[model samples]
Target: MRRTLTAALSIAMVVALSGCTLVSTLAAGDTPTDTPTPEITGSGDSTTDPSPPDDGGSDVDGSGDDGAGDGPPAIPSDVPLALGEAGEIEGRGGNPVGTFQVDGVTTGFDDCVEPEEGLSYVQVDLTITAEDDLAAEEGSLDYATSFALFLLYVKGPNGEYLGDWLGHECVPSSEWIDDVGPGESATGSVWMSVQTPVDEGLIEWRYGHQNFVVPFP
Candidate 1:
């Protein structure tokens, strides 16, 4: 009996030792992993592409934009000019000559010249044509044309004259009409300062038909 009991105890000790060994082996085999393994397997080569870098640059040329250095070319418009009469008349000096004339007015010139010690200003009377008569010929004073006066320059005894005449530049519009009231006339003036020898006499304006020699002074 004693021998049998001892053998049974020894066997139990061996079984416990074996069980501990098995548990230790399982623990050793199990390891904590950072990345989870994918279940779906891909056959073809798998690759990860890196992100691209950022660049702050522009692709704007002169043709692409405006308002900066890229602006459109400038263009001029067709402007019309007018003078009072067509023949020579008594102007500043000894009844000069009148070259400018209105289309309809029968009178010689609707203009006057005033000489003031090397300075001169002319108050020239003009007629505006009616809308219906705007088409009248150049020589006819229809008195109702939608027109504006653009005086480029004038003729002086000394030479070509440019003045505050710029003030006479007409507003751009065919729709604007200058109406003539019956016998009453429309009037405008051109102012000028003498540049050349005021005594050159017989001052024919580059534009107007009238030539003024002025009261020889």
Candidate 2:
């Protein structure tokens, strides 16, 4: 009777040990996946991070720039080029076209043309010597289109392009000449309207959907 009891006890112990072994093996293999999860950081998620690249990007400070596909190529808000400091013009193929200079800038000159209340008239003197026919067109430049197509702007004190420079239609007070052929030079003033009581800002010029700037000192 004692020997029967000992065999039974041994069988029970063996069965218990086998159950524990099987449970441990299953627990070891119960991982959801073999791949380790990627950690997220710094304006990104679900990807492993690497060393950042070194490349400059666009510099937009969120100022009011109407990016309504104005030009085929995107125009940037670069630093202002100085007045009378522009070099010889370059052709489409980058050949020298001609020369131009901002001979003078006059502000607050309200002669016969009456500006609206709280506004003033500013004029820019342009002298252009064109080697080609196209550059000559810039001499007696006329923007008969909407106000947005105006060629020149006198930036207000707030650093915004809130000025108006119409074509040479205000007749008697303007010395703006026309029919400037190639190899000839023309000097004229392009009048613009700026906010009154403005003592600072830049002057912006547009040509062929591109923009240029000349700061006010």
Candidate 3:
């Protein structure tokens, strides 16, 4: 009876160990997953999808985002070029009150000059007229009062284009007019000294997209 009970207990222990080994092998081979598990995080699960890129290859307006196409792009009109008009001086125009003709001619600007042997320089002359309401209202702001002329140029008469000369040079700036009154004419000259090979036509004049000699009007 003792030998038979011992044999029965040994059989039971073997069966229990075999069952545990089968369970571990199955768990290693077959994992439970309702969603994809990539190495990276933030990826969408089974139900959601990733977003599309901004620019579609063909540039067609309605390619991806929805049936509604992109709105029409803005188109700008060409304004007539006036005789002396610089078109716009930025910052100074658009004042509420004034007969402002940002229009003006650069009479002449000298090639790099030297007042003294050690002092080499260049100067630009311009004539501007502001009649009507703008002239009257210009006095209210002290900083907004001056008419600025920027001179764009090239180097050594042969080098690539160097930009505007008003503030780009070494010499002190010359102010033509600080403030103009109503029904009055404003005239002035500004000058600067820069280091470069000096020659005529080296400094190119620009008014909007147009390029030419000074004193256009």
Candidate 4:
């Protein structure tokens, strides 16, 4: 009887020891460990985000539509100049006359054969000098075609362009100069009829693709 009891106690002690070992192993396996996170770095072939698309907004260049219907380009600058102040003569034969200037501008003409209502006449006094002795053509200086080539117009205070006018009546018409030798000049007046009460305006002249402007007084 004593021997059997001792054997049974030995078996129980061995089983308890085995069960404790298994529990310890399971606890160790279930526990979590501290791990380090990886660092991120950019690649050499990385690309940047593209720019936004054009939304058809403001005009970067002055050539784009400004909401004001189609028309000639706006005035480059607002600098006021005078008619014939810095004019360059252009004609056949290398421009026999070189310098041209507007001596004066006269308005409110009292002598008009057929004056129309709501219109007034403006006379521009011009002095054209010859750079060299020009040969006389048909016993007179023939500048009718040259005068016709010039474009004369008016600009309102708001930069609106008025069409060209050609109905001129001068005592000595600019087209009828008798003769002009070197160091000599010819003086005359050219007239134009326009809307009355022109308080502030600009006289625009175009000659051979060149443009010039002068403030009207």
Best TM-score among the predictions, by candidate number = 2
Tell me the tens digit of each residue's lDDT in model 4 across 86-196: 455533333434555666666665566566677776666666665543332122222333333145666666667643453554344434333345556677656666676
Please give the TM-score that candidate 1 achieves against the real structure: 0.23
lDDT of 4: 0.56
Clashes of 3: 6
Off by over 4 Å in 4: 1-80, 83-86, 90-97, 130-150, 166-184
Model 1 ranges off by over 4 Å: 1-122, 125-131, 135-145, 157-159, 162-185, 193-217
Using all chains and alpha carbons, the TM-scores for the candidates as numbered come to: 0.23, 0.49, 0.33, 0.43
Question: Cα miss at 57, model 2 (Å)?
Answer: 28
Query: Who is ahead in TM-score, 1 or 3?
Result: 3
Pairs with steric clashes in candidate 2: none
Clashing pairs in 4: 81-214, 82-214
- At residue 175, give the lDDT of candidate 1: 26
Question: Between candidates 2 and 3, which one is better according to TM-score?
Answer: 2
CA lDDT, every model vs. true structure: 0.35, 0.58, 0.43, 0.56
Predicted structure 3, TM vs. truth: 0.33
**Candidate 1 colliding pairs, count:** 40
Off by over 4 Å in 2: 1-72, 76-79, 113-115, 133-149, 157-159, 167-174, 177-181
Q: Per-residue error at 69 for model 2, in Å? A: 17
